[model samples]
Target: MENWSENHNDFIDYERDEKNKKIHILIIYDISENKTRTKLVKFLLGYGYRVQKSAFEAIVTKSQLKKIIKNISNYLDEENDSIRIYRMYYDDVIIFGKNFSIEDEEIIII
Candidate 1:
C-alpha cells in the first residue's frame, strides 16, 4: 500500500494505505519430512501467529511478504512439500471454530 515496489529496500517504513488497510496472510503447508516441517514452523512463528497445527495468520507489508515467501521457498522440497500463502483483506477474513484475533501489540516469546 505504501508504494512497496518503489521502496522495496525500506520495508521498516512501509505503512498501510487507507484503501487497502491491512494485509492478512494465511499460510498453509504440508511437508513430508518431519524435520523440515518443524523448521518451517519455527521460521513462520517469527513472522506470524499459528492458528492451527499447520496454519498461520500474519499481518505483513509487501516487502515483508516478499521476504517471507523467499524464506519459505528455501525450505520447500519442490517434489514433496506444498505451501500455500493466501493474501486477503482484514475485513474479508471469517473465523469460526476458535476465537482468534490479530493484536496490534508486539508478541514476545520467552
Candidate 2:
C-alpha cells in the first residue's frame, strides 16, 4: 500500500534491510472533522490496525498486502486530505527468536 500512498514516489531511493523486519505506519485524517476522523479510524481498523483513540499500531512477520486496500479507501472521501507515515524500529526483546531491527525514520507528510 505504501506505493499507493501520497508521497510513495518520494520513497524510491530509501532502503530497508530485508534481513531485519520493521513496522511501517501510515495515518491520514482531517483533524477538524469527526466524520473524517471516524472514517480514517474505521478504515484502519477494518484493515486490522489495533486502534486506540486517535492512534493505531500493528506488527506482522510479513508485510500485509491489504495495506493498499486501506490506503485506497482514503480517496473515496471528498474532503481535503493529508497523510503521515512513521516508520519505527520494532523490537520484541521480551521474547527471544522474535524481533526486527529498524533504522531511524522520520514522520513524513505529503
Candidate 3:
C-alpha cells in the first residue's frame, strides 16, 4: 500500500495549470478617507466584481487580478491604507469563521 507521504508525493506529481482559473478572490481594503472606500467599491463593481459587506469577491483571471490590484494599490494612501487579498478555496471561509464571530466576519473576504 502507498504510504501517506508517497500518496502526497503522487498528488504533487500531477501537472497543474499555472494560469489562475476564474476563481473567486476576496479583497479587503482599508480606505479611511471619507467616500474613498465607497468610490473604489463602485469602481470594482463596475469592472464586473461584486462587493459584499465591504468585501469584494469575483471570478477574476490572473492577469485581470494583477491589473485590479494595481489600480487599487495606486489609490491607497501610502501611510494609511492596506489591502488583504485571499484566494477563496472551498472551505477557507468556514475555517476562518471558527475564530471570528458573526460581527467580526463582516469585514472578512473569504
- TM-scores of the candidates are 0.74, 0.45, 0.57
TM-score winner: 1
Q: TM-score: which is higher, 2 or 3?
A: 3
* Each prediction's whole-model lDDT (CA): 0.71, 0.44, 0.54
Higher-ranked by lDDT: 1 or 2: 1
Task: Supply the global lDDT for candidate 1.
Answer: 0.71
lDDT of 3 by residue, 5-34 (tens): 333432222233244344456777777886
Off by over 4 Å in 1: 1-22, 105-110
* Candidate 2 deviation (Cα RMSD): 9.5
Worst 10 residues of 3 by lDDT: 101-110
Error of 2 at 109 (Å): 25
**Alpha carbon deviation, residue 52, candidate 3 (Å):** 3.8
Stretches of model 3 off by over 4 angstroms after superposition: 1-20, 47-51, 95-110
Model 2 residue 103 lDDT score: 32
**Candidate 1 per-residue lDDT over residues 1-110, each given as its tens digit:** 13333454333333543345445778999998999999998888877889898899887655567777656776689888889877655777778887678764444433
CA lDDT for candidate 3: 0.54
Q: What is the C-alpha RMSD of each candidate to the true structure, in Å?
A: 5.8, 9.5, 12.6
